[model samples]
Target chain A: MRFAGRVAVSLYLLVVSLGLAVGQRSLEVCSGCEFTSLHAAVQQAAPGDRILVRGGVYREGRLLVDKPLSLLGENWPVLDGGGEVEILTITADDVQVRGFVFQNSGVSHIEDLAALKADNVSGCVVEGNRFSNNFFAIYLAGSEHCSVRNNEVTGAATSEAFSGNAIHLWNSSSIRVEGNHLSGHRDGIYLEFVQDSSVTDNISEDHLRYGLHFMFSSGNEFRRNTFQRSGAGVAVMYSKETVMVNNRFADNWGSAAYGLLLKEINDSTVADNTFFRNTVAIYSDGSNRIEVTGNEFLRNGHAVRLLATSMSMHFTHNTFTGNTFDVTTTTSRSYNDFAENYWDNYRGFDLDRDNIGDVPYRPVRLFSMTVENYPQTMILLRSPLEQFLDYAERLLPVFTPRAIEDDRPVIGKP
Target chain B: MNEAVKVMKYGFFDLLRSRWIFVYTVFFLLITGGLLTFGGDPNQAVLSALNLVLLVIPLVSLMLGLSYYYYTRDFVELILTQPVSRPAVFLGHYAGIALPLALSFLIGTGLPFAVYRAGNETDAPVVFSLLLAGLLVNLVFSALAFWIGLANEERVRALVIALGVWLGLTMVYDGLLMGFIVLMQSYPIERSLIALSLLNPIDLSRIVVLLQLDIAALLGYTGAVFQRFIGTAWGVAMSLSSLVVWIVLPLLLALRTFRRKDF
Candidate 1:
């Protein structure tokens, strides 16, 4: 009697497995097919099914996926929002959306309309998509372990009021955003309340506000990203343990612009970055324990504007060349440390042949202070009087922050 | 105009043969050529050239104009006995010295760029501005020197005053402006700063170069005020017209002094 019962249970398990394998079907959505629209195909597809969408425009208002499925596009099928609603929203787990062109989502201030939005979903993958003129390109909210990669998104943003970000993440964790080209938006990439996420190999340029913005986001890593010519450049605020490595910030020139603005940030690592021709390379206000190492600051107006409120900031192994002012501070006293840096204006010699200068190199100039307090004095840049004041101040330590000197300055590029 | 041209030709030829003018030309050549080769960047060469134009050109032009007056006094008195009008001799002598100096500057700086093919479309505007600044500075300082020579009877005194003028403009004026801005830090002094920069020809030339080299830097803080005024075409026209006025006022003053003075 026990052997017969075991055989019946095994047969029942095999029949159920066979039923699942046979029930999952691949559906095609095209002009000639019965499933003419993407919404119709998604509506009819069961859980764990695959839907292949061909190259045709589907003017669907909003296609919501409540079950796990893979929506694959052959030759980039168009998902048009008809300038009225959000195009695609995923509410289920383990859903994949790939190779679709999302276009012209409505610009409504009341609704957070997005070309593609993944909400309350886990293990969601959005890849190889192109988004243009959307209110928000790809938005992930309350999602975890999702990846948005290999996407090109551009917006027709003229101002910050009406435009949205290219890729925005809110309350998401462990999300991987990689290989995305984002431009002409309010913010290229924005993160709020996001943790343990990685943003890598992205080019963010010409945005209305910031190339990349971090608000209340902690434990995020941004690597190998190029942020250039944006309104105020990349701003990392109210975040901790954020690692920004090997990034390039260039040509963010304006009255209030900075290459990287770090406000109220703590315990962050900004390493191996290149800041070129920015009005102000790194502006740190109320930030602490920031380790800025192995960075190249070239021809910037002010290489680092370290405010008095920032503390315990370490600057080492950095190269500062051709900058108007290597360091400028708001207060005459410095709490940050600068050591073993290479300065183009260093006139000290290494008499001991140790590849380190015997004398300290003072990066701050007296004219820089005067110009900081009284910006109108900027007209005196490179003048003989300014040079004389700097020379005199170097001889007699006064006015400038005397503690902001690189005692072990590298003799050459390090 | 013909008489002025004749007198100008004589002076121009005389200066071209002088060892001092040759040294000046060679000095510029060495500076530009050395910077181009050693600095390995044309933009850097232009910046160094800007400093040379600002510091050296005004002083050299002043000394040349004043000393020429003192050394050539007998010749001037002899020329006065001729049928030439005073304005002709004065304008001719001014152009004569100014042209050779301008040419020397142009050749010394421009030859390296032409040889290197370094003046791309981006660099062309900066180069043109540098040359213009040099020429205007030369003319303005030379006119002031001539006026000083005509006003002061003693050569040593005239030379001393000319040096004082250079010192005052290049060094002391900026120092005072710095002090003033610091004192008036509470108020909005951006427009006043621009007006003050226009008051000094050296500062004006410096602004022209600053607009190019440190423009990224200048677009921030008080520098933004300068960029807004100096970066626009209208601002450019205003500064340029102001520079032209600098040349005209000094030359007009010197010409008036030359016309009424009894040799």
Candidate 2:
């Protein structure tokens, strides 16, 4: 009797495994389908089911995915907004939407409506979708473990006031935004009150405002992205424990444009980035506990501008070349630590052959210091005699920011 | 003088007659007005509008110049058969196309500013300078288009080459400059600034105008350097000289090339 029971149990297990393998069904929803709408098909879809939408202009209202289902579009299917509301709304777990074009979202300054809205969802994937002329492209609010990748968001941002972001995340955590092209929006990507999110390998250009703007967001890692010809490259504010690495911030030239602006941030790591030809490479205000390393600052208007309140940041292993100003500080009492940086303006000797300077290199210039004291001193920056004065001042540091010195300066470019 | 005025008048009327040009002008006006009304700060709004106008006007001017030259290849041929010099014809056609377009640009760009009253009083000079700079840009591109049209007998080839030149100037030149700077970082060759600044027309314009804004501090370290070298009256003189060089040298080269060509 025991042998018979064991054999029966084995047979039951085999049957269950087979059922699990073949139980997942695929539902085909075409333009000529009886349901005729993506929302209708989604409402009818069961757990572990697939809804394949064929090529057609589907004037679907906001598609609320409230079930564990896959909604796939074939041949570049378009979801028209019909001038009413958002295109897709995801409120369920384990949802996937791919390969569709979402367009024509209603403009609203009060509400942050997006072409694709992912809210309170976990393990969701949104990929290979094209969003054009939308108020906001992809918005994640209070969502977790979500991935938005390989999407194109193009906006006709006439003004910063009327237009919204291409991709915006608020109060969301553990989100990944990767491999996307975002252009011509107020901001290409914006993060607010978010934590533990990562944005990587995205190209954001031609925006009216910042290419990437993050406020009160912490524990986020931004890497391998390119911000070109935007109003500003990126703005990180009021956050802690973040990492920015290996990004190219270039050609973002304007009156107030900066490659990166760090404001009130603490305990962040910024490394291995290239800031090329921007108005300002890095502008820091009241930021602290940050480690900046292995970055190249090239041909920017100002490489680094540290404000009075900035404190406790470690800047090392960075190369500052061809910038208008290598370093500028408003006050002499900054707690920031500068060491092991390769300043193009460094004129100290390296007699020891250890790639370290024999004497401490003061990154601040006397002219810059004068500007700090009296703003009008900048009027003499390019005068023929000013060069002699600068050389004299560099030979013997005077009136420069007191605390603005780089110890252990590198002989070679970092 | 009368003939030149007549030529200008005819060119204006001819542009007005083209449906595509009218349509494009209308489209530009609508878009520029809409953007200025809705976008962020008044300064940024004006800047953005100017940027669009600068980018689009050149392309339009290039295309119009190219097509005008192509369609009126016979007219040019007839004028050449007469007692008129090729240079006069070239200059006449250039001034004719440029003046009207400049006026239209002023109208299209200026009308929005009047309607919105968005920008500050300080912004007026920059705005005016921006418009004038854009007109210069139009002239530069139109001359380039004319040169291309003259150099290449085939209309398609001329159009293609003109577009290529535009792309090279606007995008590829910057990319190359970045690459060069990265490659040559070790040397104290910051002296190359003078030569490099002269090569690109856009940089010349930016340096000259940006210096006038007196916001050099906002521009990273390079702005300080620029302020040092080129921030004063002498710097402005240098910038103006470079601009003149950019304008005249290219035209001279084009003229020589055109005169020598078998076509």
Candidate 3:
């Protein structure tokens, strides 16, 4: 009798869930409904149940979705955390959380709390969420095969240290992060130990720190993203097999600002990017085995500032115009390759009509090295004394790096 | 000619012993020396010195020209009666003040740069350009002041025009240029703007100093034409010669006016 009863209960549960999957039952969540809160609805519903949250302010501490349910908001339901914890926490696989407004996830010294925190979940969709006053907007940790898209996050961070990244992904694989607009965060998007992810068509600007802080992320591709007016634009550190293509970075001007800072990054491709009006467009520090091609640097202080530790870098088909110094380095010996780039400073004529100039273009200026060695000399910029010294150095290779030259310089803009 | 030489020799010696020359020389030495020592950067010192050249040099030149001419009016009349020609008195008196002004400027700026840039080969060009700029400013403005002095015998009008020219070149001209740029931003204003900056001596000297520094921020405004013009051996030749023209044109006018004036 006991065995028969257990079998009947199992069959009943299986049939109900299968019915929910085939024709999902809608659980209405509102003040008039039986389930007034999203948390209550989510708790009452089984796997594959759809919860329709109505438009109203829900003072929920943390709305946890433990089952594979679809929680959709109508007319943008507000989920306020009351300045304590994350608003939404998704711990189940195949969960969908969309069209919600999240606010007031309080700051913590040790714990990094977010508006929507998804952990160890796969095949989830978190989309069209508007987040404000949250420490972090969306944080995906130990999750894979998830998509975070079309989210707009504007965080309130008065101080740099108390803030968090807008879209923070860690230890994730095969995720799609796209079409997100982020501002006023420490970092727009930060990815660490993330693999095979694609971040595309995102606009990240006006942050206190970097727009995109990528570290220890491999085989990731970010394309057509606009990162402007951040502290240092984008910082890709200790990452390999990353491709940055067609990104626009501009107007990040400060004493130590760079449009794209590549530090200890290896086997990366920086292609077709536009860097305009930055203090330093591309600052490479101990980075190696990277291909920089078809990029445009305009009106930057120093378009490319390479360190002595950088090696095996190949830059080709790039256009450098209106930049103060196209390429500046601390060392006199070069370990990088720069060829087929168009430099406005190049004075050589293409007498053979081959499109390439006969004379090599030297991008590293002696004054750059002098300023690097003696930073105070920057104040003497454009003075007759400075110009004379640079002229003399260019005439005769005295102290400038003799090897840093573009041999196949294109005659015009490339 | 001998009487003119006697007058020039006496006037030169007299000005050399004056307290104003000592004060001017000491002022230059203090500023240049302070910049070289406390400014922390030779480039910074050069920039400050460029500003000094633009403002102080012109003022000093005009003052020296006006005061010396006013005080020596009776002497000039006496020399004219003592068989000295009009051109000789004008040329000798002009040289008497101009040479000493140039000398004081050279000593005042050159001393600091020499002491600071001693054996520092990299800084030599900076020092040379700075001193050259100062010396050129002295020559151009002093020569200009002599002409103004010759044209206008009245002290107030001469001083007003001198100050006016100085203000016009340094501040008002730049203001007008900036306004024009804003008004015609859509046009290809780079080439025309480069040409415009060349019309003013202050602007030209500033350009020379900027080209020397090779700093991207300041050089960015000059555009490609300026880069091509200021970055080569020919650019330096052209700019320095332009400075010469600034001196010669004004001096010739002053000499002509002085030669024709009936006292």
lDDT of each: 0.88, 0.77, 0.83
For candidate 3, the TM-score is 0.64
- DockQ of every predicted complex: 0.47, 0.05, 0.06
Q: Chain B alone: TM-score in each candidate?
A: 0.95, 0.85, 0.92
Which of the numbered candidates is closest to the native, going by highest lDDT? 1
State the fraction of real interface contacts model 1 keeps: 0.61
Local lDDT at B145 for model 3: 84
Q: For candidate 2, write residues B20-130 as lDDT tens digits.
A: 666766766787688776653345455455555445766887888889878766765666677765566666666777666666777777777666764457567766666
Give native contacts recovered, as a fraction, per prediction: 0.61, 0.09, 0.07
Candidates ranked, most accurate by lDDT first = 1, 3, 2
Lowest-sum lDDT 10-residue window in model 2 chain B: B214-223
The list of candidate 2 runs beyond 4 A from truth reads A1-23, A373-380, B1-263
For the predicted complex of model 3, DockQ is 0.06
lDDT of 1 by residue, B72-172 (tens): 67877788899989988888888888888888988998888777754467677778788888888888888888889988999899989998999999999
lDDT of 3 by residue, A1-414 (tens): 999999999999999888866877799999998788777788788788889988999997877888899889889989998889888888999999888899998788888888999999999998998999899889999999999999989988767889999999999999999999999999999999999999999999989889999899999999999999987678889989999999999977654567999999999999999998787799999999999999998878889989999999999999997677789888888799999999977878998999999989898887677667644334335434455566787778678877999999999664
Candidate 3 Cα RMSD after full superposition onto the native fold (Å): 17.3
The sequence of per-residue lDDT tens digits that candidate 1 reaches over residues A1-414 is: 999999999999998798677787789999999799888888888998899999989897898999999999999899999888999999999999999999999888998899999999999999999999998999999999999999999999998889999999999999999999999999999999999999999999999999999899999999999999998888989999999999999988776678999999999999999998788899999999999999999878889999999999999999998788899998878889999999988989999999999999999888888877887777888877887888998788778877889999999776
